[model samples]
Every structure is written in C-alpha cells, then in structure tokens.
Target: MGYQFETEKVVDFILKNSVKKVLIQLPEGLKPYGVGLAKEIEEKAGVTAYVSADPCYGACDLPIQEAEILNVDLIIHYGHSEILKEAQKRIKILYVEAKSNLDIGKVVEKSLPFLKEYRNIGLVATVQHVHKLEEAKKILEKNGKKVFIGSASGLVKYDGQVLGCDCSTAEKIKDKVEVFLYIGGGIFHPLGVFYTTKKPVITVDPYTKKILNIKEIGEKFLKRRNTIIAKFSQAKNVGVLVGLKFGQSNPQLAEKICMKYLKMIRKKELEIILTKLQPNPNPKILLEQYSTPPEIAANLLYMATYSFNDIVGKTVCDLGCGSGRLAIGAAYLGAKEVVGIDLDLAAIQTAKTNSRMVGVKVEWVVGDIEVLTGKFDTVIQNPPFGVKKHGADLKFLRKALSLANTVYSIHKSGEKNRRFIEKTVTKNLCGRITTMVETNLVIPYLFNFHKKPKYRVKVDIYRIVKK
Candidate 1:
C-alpha cells in the first residue's frame, strides 16, 4: 500500500526475464507483504512467485541454494544493495533498494542551523535518504550553502549510500568541506566521519527532525579513550587480545608478527625484528582467544574497573565471552579471578586455546550466561548489536547486572538507544551509568556477504554501577 516497494518495476523485470517461476527474498521486516506481493507479480507478469522466509543478515546473504532447489529462474532480493558483482555473475539476483517515505523538507530545515556557517559542506546519506540528498542540496543552496554529494563505492550501489564499513565519500571530500552533514537515522555511519576526520560531523535524522549531540557527546567519548590509553601506558604488563569469531581471520603470519611486534616488540619472541617500539615500557602479553578486539575490550574493562589498579586482585566476569579476550586481559593485568562464559563451543575452545597461548590463568565455561550464579566485582562484555533482534543485547545486560557489582557493556550508539539504555539501567537493572566511552567499533569481514573488506559501527562502552 505504501511506497516501500516498487511493485511495477518488479513485475516489469520478471516479465522481461521470461521466468516461469521467481523467488523473492525479504528481510524479516518485509515478510508480511509476501502474499500480496506474490499475488501482484503473478497477476501482472504471469510468473509464479515464492517468498523466502530465511534470515538475511545483509545483501551478502543470498538464498541461492534455496532458489536453486525450488528451481526459480530469478531471485528478487529486497531491502539491500548488491555486495558483490561476483555473486551476480554466479547467480541470477536483483537487489531492490527500499526507499523510505519520510519527508525531506523538515529534516533539511532542522539541519540549516548547523549548515548555515559552512558554505562549503559535504553531504552524505544511507540508501534510504540518498534519493532526497539532491532535494536537500537544493534547499541548502537556496540558503547560500554550497553542498557536495559524492558517489557510492564498493558495496554502496547508489550515490551517497554509506554502509557501516565505508564512509569514504566524506573522507574523499574532507579537505573541501568545512564540515560534513550526514543525513541518516542514527549515530551509526556518521561516526566514521568523526573518527576518520577532523571535520565536525552532524547527523540529520529524517524521522526525529533532530541532530546528534555531537559537541557534548563527542568530547565525553574521546576523554574516556584518552584515559584508557593512559591507564595502559602506566601498566607493567600489557595483554594484546584477539577474537575473530566467524573464521581464522588472523591475517598473514608476517602481518600477525608485525601487529604483535608493534605492541612493545617482545624481543625474546621475535626472530629478526631489530626495532623495539615501546609505546609503553610494560612487558606485554600476546594472548590469542576469540574475544572482542583488545583495544576495545581493554578500554571497556578500564572504564568498568575504574583503572588497572581496581582490576588487580578483583574477581571479574566476562559474559558472551568469545575467545576470552576480556577475562585473559584482566587476568594478565592482575585480576585475581576471571571467569569467561559463552554458548559457542568453538569460541570457548578458541578462548581456552588462547589462554594456553597467552599463559594467562582463567576459568572458562561453555554454557549460557544464566547458568552462573555468583556475585562478581565486575562484568565485562561485548554482546551482539541486536539491530535485528531489537532488544537482544538487553538480555545480556540484565543477566550481567544481576551477578555483578558493576557491568561494563558494549552497545551500538545513538541518542534514542542511549536514552533507552540509561532508562533500562536505572529502572530495570537498578544501576547508574558511571562512565560512558563511545567509539567506532570495527567489524572485520565476517562474511563476503558485504561489499567491503571490513566495516565499522559507532558503539558505546558503558560502565554501570549497581546502586
């Protein structure tokens, strides 16, 4: 009934393909329209249409095998752009971009105050708002602002479409603009600009007619990171943790050695690396466990424990602990007791292997977080973003809160979501946010189902103290 799907174009494409039967793959949000859409295609194009009800992470996850088994001639994948040209060649698939119906004028008006000062400003948006960028640009120009819109690259199929991984459009035009205007919904993609460049980044939310609290929020974000790095600088023994859950994405041996060597260059372990680069004079530990990136996890733990001093000789819990990054890092940093729990046997196995690899003592358990029932000094975790599941991350947060005096958790960043977390922590969990460290979280190429080799999202590290 609404403008989300362009059914006419879909029917036209099916008729042109001369396919007897076609398959339609919709994300969970769009599945309800399956019956109506199929009926429309069948009536208009005279081709039988079937809907794919499987879970889809992104455009990278095509239901090719299912379509092949069903013997469908074409696969109409909705809700994302193409991630790979190679997949297109191997399979008959068409990606349909589901444009939003949000009005552009209000969002443009709301953003003018931020844009009025910067005559030369760069503009970018996610796919939903890419179509309206030109309209936004016109409005800005009418008010004497010079707007620049860049083309999409890699997984971005249209002009100004920014994936979680790529924000090169803003970077490409960085030198030209005084500030960058990102037209999108959340604190997600706009953050890449903030992290990657010196320019001020502002996100114009079409839905809320609001902008991110960049000045107030960004400063708090950076100060926490500086504190964490400072804490690491003063430490006597540093642990470098690695956790790549989906695969053995440890890069090449030489690359791995380079990464290891740079983190204080443990001379005894190196074969011919002559230079020792010690950012800190601490004796570093290179521990391999499937955990969150050490850079993020260590900082998170720092925020939670209030410093390395607090973590030392303290009992800590790591939930959804993939590869024991947090637990081992804590153990290596001086935590007297560290327990790591995860549902994935492979991750637990990887964590145990990494414990032996790093020589840090930790209690590793393979089970759900609910199985444990002991009060802990602190809980450190990096849970799933739960963008798809709505409140999946909260479940982890609730479980950790029940068992710990303080909980350090990683979450996707946005004003609305942060408010929700704050409300939930205070009201539901009976905790208060002591420290907030927000930064861009890098997600490696988990699967080729994406266009880029890697991507990053704006994530928050919160330290919640139980009241």
Candidate 2:
C-alpha cells in the first residue's frame, strides 16, 4: 500500500482509553478503507465501530456532532493533523495522519535537472509527505544544493508543511531560498507556495512520476480569478452562504456581510429619494452651481451617519448648498435641525421646494457663507474646487470651521492640493484633520464649456474637527 492507515495505532488508542464506542472518519480518497478499519476495530479492540459516510475534507471538518448523536466515546480522524486545539477539549478525537509510504527518490531525482540553475532550494510538502522532507532534503544536498526547511507555525504540525489556506512554511524561508521544491500529489499546494513566495517552484509528484514548473499555472489561475471578479461585480442581486461547520463558523464575517447588504439597500433608497428632488433651475457659472450627484450625496450622508455618528439628532448646515442636496441628505439621515445657505435666490427656492417634496424640514437661507453666524454640531458642503474662481474653497473652509465643531467638506484631490489643505487646516484654521476619504465626483455636461457627457473627477472628503 502506498499509504499507511495505521490500524495498530487506532486499536492501541481505543484500548488505552477504554473506549466502548468509536466513530471512524476519513477523507474521500481514504473512505473506501473506512469499512475495513471499522471491522478491524470491532475485532481487535472489541468495541462498537461506526463509519461516517459524509465526506471529510480535513481534520478541522470532524464529525463531532455525529459522534455525539451516535453516543460514541471517541472519534478517529484520518489523513490530516490537529488544527483545532479548542475542539479537542469538547470531545475525544484521535488524529491519525495517514502518512504516504511512497518513495520520493525517483521523483526528486527527476526534479534535479530543473533545479540545476539554483544553488539554494526551499523544501516543502503536504501533511502526507511531511515526514519524508528530511529524506528528500538529503538527496538535494548530495546533488550540490543547499536545502532549507521552514519551522512549523500555527496549524502546520511539522516543519516545511503547507496547507491549502496557509503557506507560512514557504513565506518563512522565501528570502533565503532561490527556488522551491514541493513533494506533493496535487498542484494546489505547489501553486500556493509559488504565489506566496513568488519564487520559481518545481513540483515532484511521487504518484504520477512527473515534474512540473508551476509559474505558468499560477499566472493562468490569477487571470481566471480576475475575470470572475469583474463579472461578479456587475451582478445586481447577490446571495451569501455562511458555513456552520465546527471550524468554518465565522459569526463576525457573516454579520459584516449582512450589514454590508443592508447598507447597500439603504443607499439605493436614499439615491432614489434624492433623484426625485427639484434641481436648481438657474445655475450661475461663477458660483460653480453644479448640483451634487444623488449617488455621491447618498454615500456622503451614509458615511456621516453610520461611520462617524455625526448626522442624526445633530445641527447640520450645508455651506454653499447648491439646490440643497447635502443639506437634504443630512435631514433625511435624522438630523435634529438642518440649514441650507446659498447666495443664489433661485437655488434657495429650489432647495425649499425640494425639502417640502421630500417631507423633511430644512431652514433654507439665501445668503453668502461669510454672512452665516450660529454654531452647529456638523456642517457638510461640496464647495467649488477654485477652478473658475481662485481661493474659493479656502473661503468656505474658513467660514465652516468658524460655524461648526465638525465639518465634512469635499475638494479636488491631488498631492499638492491635499498637502496645502492639510497645512491650512492644522496651522491657519486651528482645526485637525480626522479622516480623508478619496472618492470620485461625476460632473455632467451642464455648461457650454463642458466637453464630455460626464467627467469623473477624483475628489477627497475631508472630515475636519475643531481643536
């Protein structure tokens, strides 16, 4: 047999523990021998043996609940080593790592020619070939190559052992080794090693007597993955499946997914509400009276409400509020009071009509930012980027800082402009920058100077707090 099932050790464990009943679990490849092992346990150990027909993926996927239902005293998990140290305290589990007994000398010799160009070689193997790593290392050393084996960490029980989800063994010795030689059956382990280390990998399959270089395979896998992600993002509705297995239970991850889905729903509803509002009929070119995009306004309000907790039951003022998109969003997000101030009378009238249409109360004032006076808890604004008018954004920032304790302001994003804004807020305005999020602002073709149907300008939302 190429693999050792270790029937004697299983009998020894059952007898030593005085186990009266036991459950046998094995991987798909080793499942056919499960019945034979169950019979052997009954004959030698004189105990009741039950074999689980369900597929076992790893030691982590133990049939603890099934064993409990059967009232078995112990569980015999084969083909992998221990991963869940906490689960062992709940039940008695004997992990029998069904080690492969195949000689890897011929395969290692086959990989020698491929590794001839490299002097340093990193040796790694799966759990089945972990015990044979030293034997393979000696062969590589005799061929004028220095071999390095990584120390075991986390779920890996032995040095140079690699799991499908973990490649720390390869990562630990990545810098020291020029190339890696993996002795395993499949391409999964070797592909993980190549991606983790980004080093040339030569896989020696002892069963197939084949040697493969996995660089091209890894590249192809990445291309396929990217294509899948691109197609998946275009999906309108998505369903999430949560695993409830002993080792696969992740309540925190599941909760995050649910929260993310709910947030998307809320944003979509808010965007629809904002789109139905009245836009400014007469927009002045010098004031840059471009109405805020409904999607972008919804995102900004959501961030303020959920992420920063600054919107609900707080006094909010939208400076340079063109057609009142930001101010209306703040009110929709449950602000205690909202104020919209704009120099244009037509924009202010549009804002008042829009607020009444949405059934939200907002105090719309037709005035300049410099004339605005009272204190507020939060102020959100999408001021002009000082493109047509110079230093226009600074004027709004200076006035907003004077009126509110916290301000959410949007500005054009660039390295030089960002540095200037940071310096001005900290030094001149006597305020501190709390958060700066980069997002895109869509500019539709509203004016004659506009060249495209729409332009996506990179912008940053600066969350400034008073010192």
Candidate 3:
C-alpha cells in the first residue's frame, strides 16, 4: 500500500495564500517522490514549483534560503514539523506530512496478550505513524485496556507524535499509564520511552508483526551502564571531550559532570576540557564537532597518550576531522606529526583555514580514512555515532586501532553501547578500554526542527589500549 501524501491540502494551502512560485523540500527518504509531487502541485495550483535537491536533515533544515534564492512565493515541506516560528513568518510554508498507511489493527491484535496486563497505556508514535494511531487507540479502547495519547505541547504540535529530540508527549503521560504502548515500528522510539520512564514497553511494529516487550532490553542497558559507572569510579586524570556539531556540543553540562566526577573519583591533579577547536572550557569558542567535548577529548587524549613515549613529539591522527579542530589541537599540544582525515571537502578546507588562523602546522587530507594507511603513536577521533549508518563508528574504531597502539574515541552513552563497544573493540581491534568518562553533550539548535536553544546528549569517551 502507498503512503498517505495529503497533497490536496498542499494545493488548498497554496491557493489560499494566493502564491505563484513554490519551493518544495522533502527529506532524503521522501526525495524519490519529489519530482512527481512537484509536478502535481504545479498542475493543480498553477504555480511554478521547484524541488530542493540539497539534503534535508530534519524539519529544522527548512529551505527558506532556497526559497529566497529561487524567489518562490511559497514552500511545500514534507516529512517534518515547522521547527522555526520566525522563519515561517518570513517564508510562507505548507507542511505536508507524508504519513504511512500501515494498519496498526493487526499488530494491536497480536499484542493483546502482552498488553492485557496493563490497565492503562500511554501511546506514542513518530511523525510517520501519528495519523494512524487513532486506529490502534480504538482497538485498545474497545478491549479492556484504557489508552492515553498525550495532547500537543511544547515543541511538538501533534498529540501523541514524537520527534527524535522531543518526546514530551510520552513523558507527560508516563505516570498516568500502567504500561507504554509505542504504536509504531522499530526499537528506537520505544527504547526512548523505556529509557525515560523505566517502564515495560509493548512495541507494536505493524510492518514486522512483532510485539516486543522492551523490559529485557532495558535490563540489559541498566546492567551495562552499571558496569561503566563502576569503572568510572576509578578515573583520575579525566578528559571531557567537547564537540561542536550544533546538535552534539555541550560545555555547561560537561563542566557539571566533570566537577561531579572530580568530587566522586580520586583526584590525579589533571582535569582538562579537550576540544578539537579550543582546549579551554570557554563555551564561547565551542565550535561544533561530532565527537567528545574539549575536556573529554583531552581526557581521551591524556588516557591514550599519557603513558605514550611523547605527546609533544609524537605522531597523532584524527579521523573525520571536521574543521580540523582535533588536528590543530594536537599540533598546538606539540605533536610533531599530526594528520586529519575527512570525506567532506568543505570541512577539510575550513580546517586548513582554521589551522592557518591558529598558526599550527598539521597535514590535512580529504578522503576516506580507510584509503590511507600509516602508523601513529596515538589516534584520536570523533566518528559518527552510527545512528544513521549502522556501525559507522566501528569503522573508525577499527581504523584507529589499526594505525595506533592507543586510541581515544567518543560514543553516545547507553547501556547497549557498553557491551557492544567492549565486544567490538576487543574482537576487531584486539583492544580494551583502559579509561572511560561519561558526560552530557550540549547540542544547540542549528536547524528549524530544534525548538530549544540546545538539547542534552549523554556520551562516553574511551581510551582503548592494545592487549
């Protein structure tokens, strides 16, 4: 069955606004349908429609600039909410949520046994299935169970709908419900509920016809995190990595965690906020990278390089060197040979300029880290968390471990990650974590989809040493 694209509403909105030229933007998954969507809009509304080809990350990444560049009178955005209020005033937007058509009745039917235990259940779904949640709600209500779908509040405008960053809908009704019923697909959204509320979750995946009880998953997560916490009890000379990616950097929270750890752990006299751009804890210079914060980066660096032959005269490599922050920092710290690698040409160019501005000498290369091969005394990197590309971080870990005896890297903090990171590092790289630190990363709102000034991300910095 085809997904529901309410394009007629798009025409109504365009005609109502009396717009002529329209700019249409779609997310990566919905881009395949953009051409057809644009053609239909133009034919019905009699407006000139141009589809934005540039990648769209979320609703936050609206094509307002593109609309202005094309001089379009209106924009038809698909697959996300209106993230920026001010931008909507300047550029007229018609948001077309391409909701899915998968029937939740069958899945709800299959979930009867698991859900029978709960008297009341709080229901939530991602934007894709928000429209169809009513069907599932009806089935649940008709049975003995009482259903509670949270009303629209805060950043999210839809009742019971959740964005990746905003899950208030579920959080709001968590106490009222006996169990959480995620009326959508996948473990991701449901896991968020389990993490937030520590409640048993019945994940009704219509596509897979699998009703998953996420209690075991939550227990596994808790067990792993408990272990990591125990290890952190011993960390002395800690580095808190500070990243600058608009969604990943957080200095204020990093400081709090660092201070908290200092109070809890036995002190070794060295605590630094290691950043790729700035080593200091100055939040003003928190240029965005996707890895750990500066202090955490330094912690990882210190952990990886402390026992090393030399840091001032050592070789260091930073994979996925966004804007050359890590590479420049390594050079400034007196590393004799420092190399930074990234696939993004623009980021590499920016890194070069940053290096020049800082008066630092570092070799910058534009290519996949996998293509290059060389030995370094230490390797430090903030690779992608693999949220989009599964095991993307593992690729960097394997490469970094191959090139150096010691590696310092950052990853999203979670119980599932503990076992995975330990198992993967030991099996693939023949390495184990000699040191680790957990801290909150502040992710500022860069795109329209982000309503708050920033979001908090829990991340872990690890120093892996060869066995």
Candidate 4:
C-alpha cells in the first residue's frame, strides 16, 4: 500500500504561522533519515530547524518543557500523534506518519544465510512493522525452520495502538528462539531485540534493502546506552537521572521528581521550590512479583550504612525516596525531624500509607530535589542513580552543601569526580569533606525486564561538615 503526506499542507502551516525556528521530533527508527529531512527542509524553506535526537516512542512521552524553553513556533513531531494537547497553542505540533515500505520477502530472503542450520527462529519488529510478522514467520517456516512470533505489545499510546517506537514483540520471545531476525529499516528496530536478549540479531535495512550483521553482545550493550543518551541530550531544561532504587520497578525517579514539582507548584510560579523524596521500606510482595532494579538497592543501602554522628534532633532531608525507606529509617534513628521527598506519586502515596502503617511521623513532601531550598541542620539522601536516572547525582551533590551545614550524599562509587567534589566543597563552602563509607550492592534476578545479568552497583557515602 502506498500513502502520501500533504507536504504542501505542512509547508503552508509553517508559512501561515510565519515560523522560522522549527523543532523536529524524529522517530527512533527514522532519526537518521529525519535528520536529513530536517536539514533539507531548512535549506529549502530558509528556516532555523532543530531535530530532536530523542525520538519519542509514542505521543509526547518526552517532556515538552524543553521545546517551550526554546520558544519554538512549530514542532515537526514524526512517527506519533500529539499526546499533549495543552502544548498545542504555544507549540504548533505536526505529527508525521511513518509506515514501513520495505519488501518483507526480500528481508526474509536476505536473513536465510545467517540462520545457519538453526531450525527454530523468531520474527519480530516494532508495532508499525508488525504487519509483516506473519509473512516473515511463514517464509521462515517454509524454509524448514520452526518459527515463533513474539506476542509482546510495545509501548501503547491509547488502546491497541503501539507506541511509535517499541520492540516489545522482539524482546518477549527472544529467549525461546535460537536466532532472532529483525526485518526493519534501521538499527533502532533490532537494537532493542539485541539488548533484551542474547539471541544473535540480524537487521535488514528497508531503505537499502540489505541485511547487516550486528556486533557481539558486549559491544551491543554499550551501543544501546550511547543511543539512549544521544536521544536524551536534545532536551533543554529537563534531564533524567536513574540509579539504583530500593524497589522492583525501574521507574525514572528523576522524572517522577520533576512531575511532582509540576503538580505542587504550577509552571507559572516564578520561584521554584526544590525538594527531595527518598522513599524507604519495601514490600516483599513487589519483590516476589518482580526483581528490583539493581541500582535502587545499591543507593538505599549506601545511605543506610553510612555513619554520621551529632545529627540527632536536626532537620534532615531524603531526596528521591523510593518508598520512604530512608526517611523512616532516619526518623527511627532520632533525627529532630525528617522530610522524605520523591517525584513518584506512587512512591510518595505509598510512603504516606506506609508511614501510617509503621507509626512514623515523617513529613512526606513531593517535589524535585534539584529545586529544593531552605537551610537545614543536616541533609542526607540516596539520590536516584545514573543507570536508570541520569541527573540526580550531579544535581543532588551540587545542591547538598547549600542546603545544610553538614551534607551527606550517597552516589555511585568509583566516579572520577569524587576528588573534584571535595575540592569544590572546600573552595565554595570553606569545608573539608570526608568519605564515611563505601558499599557494594549486588542483586540477582532483579532485572527481569533487562537483557543483562545481575547488576553490581558501588555506592560512595560522603560526610561533609563545616570547617
């Protein structure tokens, strides 16, 4: 089936708005292509164009605050529809539809050589390309290979619609098959499949109609992380930092923190209130159902085990509290008062319920630790990590000394900036810092959703007191 887009209509819309600065949201699969199109449009239309490297999976999963900051007149968001209707007025969003035009038979034909003598093979692709799945399966099966079609749904926008960029279908049944074949246009389609499972991945590019062999497992891991980081850098104001959390779900703690601030203080508010929530306490039920992200356990344990004295009856803070675990632990240990802050409403909501359950009188404030203010006697928090959350450690450490006379921060151990932090603190705050503790947390079977084995995250605990 051949389809055509109204390019003139898009051009007319831009012309009507007198738009010069345009932001283009590329699809993950089509980012490299979209970048080219964006550059072409800029040259032809004589407009300033920005192509976001971070192609949204579906709708507006990525935050639009960065676009708003750019003062962009129009957003050329490709692959998905406009998920956020509110940003429509300030940001004119035009979603470009991206559908597969590859020859499935040719893709199947090209993949035969890599099959070797394997009898069982699995076929998968992103939701937009899933229509070719059965055809791919039939072709593989016809060649005397047992074929399995992965039944996992990618990120869904509304109902029954796949998120514009997800390979859940490939990831779900990757383990069952001996070889995985990715029949898509770009490396993005196969990269997800390769990461989630170790099955040898082969990608067939639709644009060129050729199959390319992928890298080995180790290289693929590093590639996936770099690809994700490249996408994340396009945003202006907002940043995501992930680390070891104490819970099962690998939720973006930094994102949850920013969302919390969005709720508490409207965007119109001038002075931003910066706060942190580190939820402590874990329900065995969640762990029983799913393994916790390795980083979570690593971070919380670092905060709990670090020894600091003379902090009793002093106001204390816990940033990115997952389930109020650290806050409750602080209160129990005799802090004058303790405030637990987190962006995850579920975590904060759970913390409140758990606080009552455990009979702890802890103040649970929901906000971003990065924007938190007001001085305190002591500030301690196991901020979200870099593995899952990216900006928390830097943000938390940067703001810690400003928040209290005595600052304690827990972050990934072995980071190169430990000495730099010591230097900055001594210079800025006129204080000397001391390393209090170092902890290592290794959790196996925690990342059921991850492609890698058990993760071991190192935690560094620093205790900073005034000179």
> Higher-lDDT candidate among 1 and 4?
1
Tens-place lDDT per residue, model 2, 328-372, is 989988999999999999999999889988889999888888888
The top-ranked prediction according to TM-score is 2
Please count the clashing residue pairs in each candidate, in the order shown: 5, 0, 31, 37
lDDT of 4 by residue, 147-205 (tens): 87756433433221223255556556666788777765666556656666656777765
lDDT of 3 by residue, 1-467 (tens): 35678978888888888999998888877899999988988899899999889887667777666688799998888888776676677778777777887777788888889977688988898788888778888888899778899888877978998776777888888889989888766676687778777678888886778889988887576556644653544465568898543334579999998886655313232232123243212222223344344555444454444333335688999898877666776776678899988877777877787788778898989898998797998888888888767778888999998898878788889999988999998787799675567777777655555699988988887777787
Q: Which sequence of candidate numbers ranks them by lDDT, best first?
A: 2, 3, 1, 4
Alpha-carbon TM-score of each model against the true structure: 0.48, 0.57, 0.49, 0.39
lDDT of 1 by residue, 241-341 (tens): 55332222344654775565366423222211111111111211221121365566655554444343447688889988876767777776668899999
Which candidate achieves the best lDDT against the true structure? 2
Looking at model 2, residue 202 earns an lDDT score of: 93
| Candidate 2 CA-lDDT value | 0.87
Model 2: per-residue Cα lDDT at residue 305? 78
For model 1, the run of ten residues with the poorest summed lDDT? 271-280
79: Cα error in model 2, Å? 1.0
- For model 2 the local lDDT of residue 286 reads 90
How large an RMSD does model 4 have?
Answer: 19.3
Q: Give the TM-score (vs. native) of candidate 3.
A: 0.49
Off by over 4 Å in 1: 1-4, 27-35, 46-57, 69-71, 152-155, 214-467
